[model samples]
Target chain A: MIEARGLTKRYGDLVAVNDVSFEVGSGEVVGFLGPNGAGKTTTMRILTGFVPATDGTAKIAGHDIFEDPLAARRAIGYLPETPPLYPEMDVAHYLTYVARLKDVPRGRRKGAVDRAMERCGLADVRRRVIGSLSKGYRQRVGLAQAIVHDPAVLILDEPTVGLDPIQIREIRGLIAGLADSQEGGTGHTVILSTHILAEVEAICRRVMLINAGRKVLDGPLAELTRDGQRLEDVFTRVTLSDQAEASAGGTAEAAEAAQ
Target chain B: MRHVGAIAGRELRSMFVSPVAYAILTLFAIVAGFFFLASVLGFDAQVAEAQQFRAFDYLRQLNLNDHVIAPFYGIMWIVLLFLVPGITMGLFASEKTNGTQELLMTSPITIWELVIGKFLAASLFVLLLVGMVGIFTGILFFFGDPELPKAASGLLGLTLVALSYVAVGSFASSVTRNQLIAFFLSLVLLLILWMLSIVADLGAGGGAIASDGLVSRSMRWLSSADRFEQMVRGLVDTKDLAYFGFMIGTFLILTKASIESVRWR
Candidate 1:
């Protein structure tokens, strides 16, 4: 399970994530939806312990992200806003290195590396240098590194951001399969952040909509968009309504001043 | 410790896999070898002439002792200045630039583990460089009488100097995502430290007023040149050892703190 309470991140005068709180239970796939600069990435960083919260707490698998970060980190796997990779390393070497660094038992290290490669469809390109790989293959290598240790929670930020349509579908399928597969199962709780609404509707059971650094909506995907409404319609309504209200309020102030 | 080893192994492998490592090794070999060969030839000529003269003049001509040793340290320092930055500039800079820092940061490892691991990896490369120098030093032994103690002390000094440089380089790399910036920063910081003793000497000579008189004195203590001089002279002063240890420790701690502060950003 992953839990966050009053999580906040501020950069100088800008509040990136303000008082955000949520939880995801085991066997849950939660989609984090937001427009550009909506603090989705910021929140994911905090949960993974990549960035610390300004004035709040986050726990992963019962371990506090700040108080016991290593423990919390041990329970989670993360792919950041951009997939982290060492371009000079070959695919097999990179995954094996990550597997060892993730503390896969020495005896199981080889097997873990192999499993991550096979699962990510990187077996064919195992010998290829990562610097020479295509974007899609690199993304898969990034995913392979994340799941090498098979942690209880997976936090992927824009996992499908730059992939071709076919690669996107394949990655989405991989995520879904990993979330449900028995051998790969840790009842793995996944928090996937993306702006692509269709992917969310297809992969996420629960959804959270964030706007301007705050959560504006949170619930199941189906219930959040009832009446057979498209996910995009609900998203537009939530975000655009805020923009329209601000504009209308500005106009009202101007009219009053003219009067 | 296992985590540190894991990171070190990966870093070491990456160093070998990339052309940068080979480039550094080749450059170091050429530069270090030329300097060593030149010094040995010069010393051998002087020794041959001294042998033809009286035994008393032989003692006077042995003044070349410092000259021969100075070149070894000089060339080693130059090689280290160029090569340490290459090994370390990309350690954290590439991680941040390429976004792998996020993955490593989120892993189940402490900041200390990361710092030490990276430092060790860079240090291992330095060790390899030092080892090659040792091979050339061995070749010197094949010629005329070589001062084994002085040679060993010089190697020791080189190792400590490399450790200090790697620590500072790692810290510099951690503060930025640009490898070029990291390299320049490390070089500039090292240059400042390298020149500190000269600046202090000038201050003491009234060339410039010491703004912070105590700082100038401490700067002398921090001088890599001063430490290496003592080490090359075969004096293993605990205080000098402590200074290098302190330098490496200070930078490693800075690296850890710098990485931790990113969490707040």
Candidate 2:
């Protein structure tokens, strides 16, 4: 339900996202893997309508990001790298506000917030201010917000960042459930970016990798690492091969361009 | 719109959730209370002197609008100039600093909905300050006569000026992620806005709709403080109303442009 065609984002001479293109069909969970400064966040931002692409287009559930930003955004539930939380707001109240912004029906807003909290395992801390919560709970709150409206598409940027191993497992399980659950006889379409290679194996169905703003690899998770080959070696081979070639040729764009 | 209301409601609640709201309210209350008492006491001293001199006719002619309410309203405006920046600096800048702006940016709401919602919340918070002035004005009627129309018009003028302050402040906040920069930027802009209008007030000789010349006409257009001055004179001309509407609209558009520019950046 996500289509990105030649999505390029340039900040002056720096091409943050260079003509990157990919598509994730409905009920597919795609893991977006990239190193630091690889433009993964920028690509996600462009798709979620947080920022405009410099020279391309993206559509979420058939709604163009540029032409119909409101409707396009209506189909998306985005969790940015930082989780976009208000420290002073309590968990339940904050979710209700987000539900309102997402245009969840007034009668069902309470139910939506409750369900989100329930799904994220955030019931006991509903009245606790976000600032007072532990890192795991804060991450859970972030996850709760993404599913609060039950949107058709979920674009999460490093959803498990800064969480403990147990918390990470919980979040991964939650995402896995989102991908396969028969909540409405269909699962949510999700594209999550992460630095952890194991994260993809744990939850994601497919894998899309980008390096220096370009998609270097996009394929099924199993096929990409078949024959007992580990995912890390494959990830390094695809991402670092370009760097090795650029450095050997003494090209100025070797690694600084991404930074 | 419902979207606007939802955003505005959160803004208001968030403000109260933080300490800034109570601190600014207490600050306005203490400062405004002192100004009110000072004006009333000064008016009492004048009345006592007039009675001592047996200037009965002059005492009869003396009105509360000129000696008490008008000056109090002017002081209220000055108080607003300082406190308004506090109210608006966090409107957008705090969202950026805390990274909560992403939530709003990715939502289904339009840019206008976000800007107008924060603007509405800021105006409502400042209205409570105006409401405090109402209580002081009420006390004036308790012991003496202050023209009702004049008082009402002055409050309206105060509200209009506040709307303009909030508009400018929101614009200032949208341009920066630092709350300190936002606060000082809007403070300077509000001060400049107030000063330029006072210049127009001086040029027009503080008269009602002084359009005798092109210079005065332009001066009237620049007159933010002058509009309040006219309203204090119990004048609610269309010119003053139009000027405020223009100020609020211009800054609202500017704020929206600044936000949209950030998305492009």
Considering every candidate listed, which one attains the maximal lDDT? Answer: 2
Every model's DockQ: 0.76, 0.83
> In DockQ, how does model 2 score against the reference complex?
0.83
The C-alpha TM-scores of every prediction are 0.93, 0.94
Error of 1 at A90 (Å): 1.9
Q: What are the RMSDs of all candidates, in order?
A: 2.8, 3.7
Candidate 2 lDDT, tens digit per residue, B45-65? 989999999999989877898
Candidate 1 chain A, poorest ten consecutive residues by summed lDDT: A179-188
Residue pairs in clash, model 1? A52-B263
**Each model's iRMS:** 1.3, 0.8
lDDT of 1 by residue, B113-203 (tens): 8899999999999999989888877876665556788878877888899899999999999999999999999999998889989888888
**Going through the candidates in order, what is chain B's TM-score?**
0.92, 0.92
